[model samples]
Each structure stands twice: as structure tokens, then as C-alpha cells.
Target: MSGHGFHVHGPHDHELEHAAHGNDDFASRIAVMTAIMATVGALFGYEGGATQNDAAMFKNEAAIKKTEAANQWNFYQSKSSKQNLAELAMVLPGADAEKYKAKVARYESEKEAIKKDAEKLEAESKEWEEKSENALHQHHRWAQAMTAVQIAISLAAITLLTKKKWLQYASYGVAGIGVALAGLAWFHI
Candidate 1:
């Protein structure tokens, strides 16, 4: 028994280990192919987890940016209301109309700045959302690749048990598909 937790050799692993050292060429080939497929599956699994984590982080960033954008928009609205009141003050009789006009101008400029900042933050949030979606898509691709590789390994185990040449060929085909999926993941397709 190994010291590592959750590490248990399956019956197929024992058979594969035995076949790997056996004199039968067919068994040896299947064993080697299954070993390679397992390695590829592990790598795909790792990438899938990493991409999922990245997606979560990107989504969190998008949420934060969206909140900041909302805050800026609220600030812009507040400034607009203040500007309207200042304009009304300028119309009141005996009011400091010059001071009210200057206050209105300042509020107008501030609102413009706030509007621009909010728009920029909204764009940033959208960009982060797109990034999160892409990462999720990539994670799905990696998961598919890992699934195919696991199926290939299973087929290899069956081939080893039954000594079926056709099963071996099918396992090879599935392994190729797994590699292709991994390629698609790498390319973000």
C-alpha cells in the first residue's frame, strides 16, 4: 500500500502491470498504450481544473467591475439631480444666479466624467465576462478530452482481458480523439 491518500491500484492496473512485463507482444503493446493514455488523461484533468478555476476568478472580477460601474452610474445620477436643482436655483428671484450657474456647470462636467468612468467600467466588466466564458469553454474541452482518454483506457483494459485485436484498434482511435480534443482546448476552440 502506498502512503499517498486516495491512491489505489485498480484490478485493471494490476493486469496492466503484469501484461507490461509479460512475454506476449499484444499484451505489452496494450499495456503501454493504456499507460500513455492514463498520463494524457491526467494532464487533461489538470488543465480542466485549472481552466475552471480561471473561469471562476474571471467571473468574480466581472462581478466586481459591474458593481463598480453601477456605483459610478449612481454617482452620475446624483450629479444630474444636483445640476437640475442648481439650474432651478438660478431662476429663483434675488438668488445668487451667477453662483448657481457656476454650480450647474461644475455638476455637468462632473456628470460627464462620472458617465465616462462608468462606461469604461462597464466595458471592462463585459471583457471579463467574455474571458470567463472562454475559459469555461476551454475547461469543457479539456473535460471532453479527459473523458475520451478514460474511455480509451477502459477499452485497452478490455482488450487486455479478451486479447481482442479490434478492441485495441478502437482504443487507439479513441486515444487519438482524446489528443485532438486536447488540441482544441489548447487552441481555445
Candidate 2:
């Protein structure tokens, strides 16, 4: 019976052991969670940046198309004016030039409308830019949270390994790397 009796640690020893175990568990959990959060942050950042790039590209394409359409309209108006002049010279030499001038004025009005439409599209594109910035800001916050978790985990690990030289050194190495990664995230990378 004496030999079968369980070995019991004193209250202080038990408490220290418990604290070490708790720190170890907390550190491992936080490390895993930090990895997950970091991955999520990276994905969100990429998606946000891509959306912004797409919006800018769409805006450029729309502007180019609008310009081309306006130029084509101008070309048509110029050709019509030339045809009117030729007809007047051959069929009615004394016809007033104001009729041909009126066609030019209509084309000018159409150009102004096209310009306004392009401006409206650009304004909407600017709104999209703001949305993209918002998304990026959200991603930034997520990254900061993830980094904090990583640092917490590392500190917990360091505390847990305080009594074991080998484990302490290993934890230190791991914590160093985690800290470097967290720094990179915070600084935007």
C-alpha cells in the first residue's frame, strides 16, 4: 500500500506546474489561431487591391470608348458640312451657309453630352475607389489583430519554458521568427 500511494506535490509546486501547463496550452492555441488570422488577412488584402485595380481599368476603357465615339461623331459632322458646301455650289449657289453651320452646332452639343456622361462615370469610379480603400482598411485591422495574437502566443511560450533550458531556447527561436513576421505585417508587407 505504501509503494502504491500516489506521489503528491506540495501546494506551491502544484501551482507552479499548473501555471506552466496553462501557459503552454495558451501559447499553442494562440500560435495556431494567429496563423489562421494572418492567412485570412492576406486574402482580404489581395481581393481588395484587385477590386480597386479592376475599377480603375474599367474607368480607363470607358473613357477611351467615349473619346472614340465623340471623334467619330465629329468626323461625320465634318463630312456632312463638306457635302452641304458642294451641293450648294452646284445646285443653289446663293443658299445661306447657316444651314450647314447648324449641323456643326448639333454635333458640338452631342460632344458635350458625351463628355458629361464620361464625367459621371468617372465620379462613380471614384466612389468605387473609396470602397476599395475601406476594404483595405478592414484588412489592415485584421492583420493587426493577427499580429497581436502571435506576439501573445510567443510571450506565453516563453513564460512556460522558463524552467527548461532546451525548451526555453526553442521557444525563443520560434518567438523571434513570429515577432519578425508580425513586424512585417504591421509595416505593410
Candidate 3:
């Protein structure tokens, strides 16, 4: 019996004890690797969530801008219709012919101003839509990176259970890919 009050039964038990010690070392190494992978995976996951939130915000803003643009276009159309009615009134031979002509000219100017404003709003709306698309694309990239990291972490867990060096290597390779993807997401590429 040793100081711990435990004794090996025979030479076979001694060999088994040595093998167990070796396995312990391997298990400790796997634990350390798993901790590192989990840390990295958590960080990437957070970034992915943030990017997804940003994408949603941008999409909402784009929708609002588009609605505003549509309203502006509708207003412009109303002005155009008023101008057309004024032109028809001018064609009538009546005491108000001169007045109608003046009204027509005023409506024309107003329509031109309204058209410019509507066009400007439409352009702005398009710009917002483009921004939303870009954010959504970035979100997808971040999500993919997060998925890779999660898969790597799962592989690491499996490697720990199986005590397989090859599986550990595969986990590390997958982790490397996850890190690369995280880098790309960080740069918004």
C-alpha cells in the first residue's frame, strides 16, 4: 500500500496504471484545447449576433425610406394630374381662359419641382436599400463563421471523449477555418 492506501494487484495492474496516467495527460491536453476553442467560439458568436441585429436595423430603415419615396411619387402624380386639368381648362374659350393659362403655368412649375423632389427621394431610397443589402450580406458571412466555430467546438468535444489525436487535429483544422472566417467578417469582406 502506498501513502494513499491503495496498492496495485500485480504487474498487469501496474501497466494499466501507467496507461491510465498517459490517458490523463492526453485528457488534460484536450481539456485545455477545448477551453480555448470555446472562448473563440463565444466571441465569434457574439459578433455574428451583433451583425445580424445591424442587418435588421438597416432593413427596417430601407423599408421606411421606400415608403417615403412612394408617398413622394404619389404627391408628384397628383400635381401632374392637376396640371393636366389646368391645361384642359385653358383650351376652353371662356372669360377664365387667361386665368386658366396662368394656373397651368404655375402648375407646370410646381410639377417640375415636385418631380425633382420625388426623383431625389427615390434615389435616396435606393441608396438605403443598397446599404441594407450590404449589411445583410455581412450578417450572412458572420453567421457562417459562427456555424464553423460551433462545429469546431463540437468536434473538439468529440475528440475529448474519444481520445483520438486525429480527431483533435481535425478539430483544430476546422477551428482554423472558423478563425479565418471571423477575420473576414471583422473586415466586412
Q: Which candidate is the best by lDDT?
A: 1
Model 1 per-residue lDDT tens digits across residues 1-189:
576565788879988787566689887788789888898899999999999999999999999999999999999999999999999999999999999999999999999899999999999999999999999999999999999999999999999899999999999999999999999999998
Ranking by TM-score: 1, 3, 2
Off by over 4 Å in 2: 1-96, 163-189
TM-score of each: 0.87, 0.42, 0.83
Question: What is candidate 2's CA lDDT for residue 69?
Answer: 55
Model 1 stretches astray by more than 4 angstroms: 1-22
Give the TM-score (vs. native) of candidate 2. Answer: 0.42
For residue 39, what is the lDDT in candidate 3? 86
Q: Can you write out model 3's per-residue Cα lDDT over 1-189, one digit (the tens) per residue?
A: 687999658869877777677658777877788788788878877877887787778777777777877887788788778878988887876648888788878878887887787777777777777777777777777778778877887888899878889998998898888888888888878
True-structure RMSD, every candidate: 7.7, 9.7, 4.9
Per-residue accuracy of model 2 over 156-186 as CA lDDT, tens digit each? 4555546444554454455455445445545
Candidate number with the higher lDDT (2 or 3): 3
Comparing 1 and 2 by TM-score, which wins? 1
Residue 7 error, candidate 3, Å: 17
Instruction: Please give the distance, in angstroms, between residue 101's alpha carbon in candidate 1 and its true position after superposition.
Output: 0.7
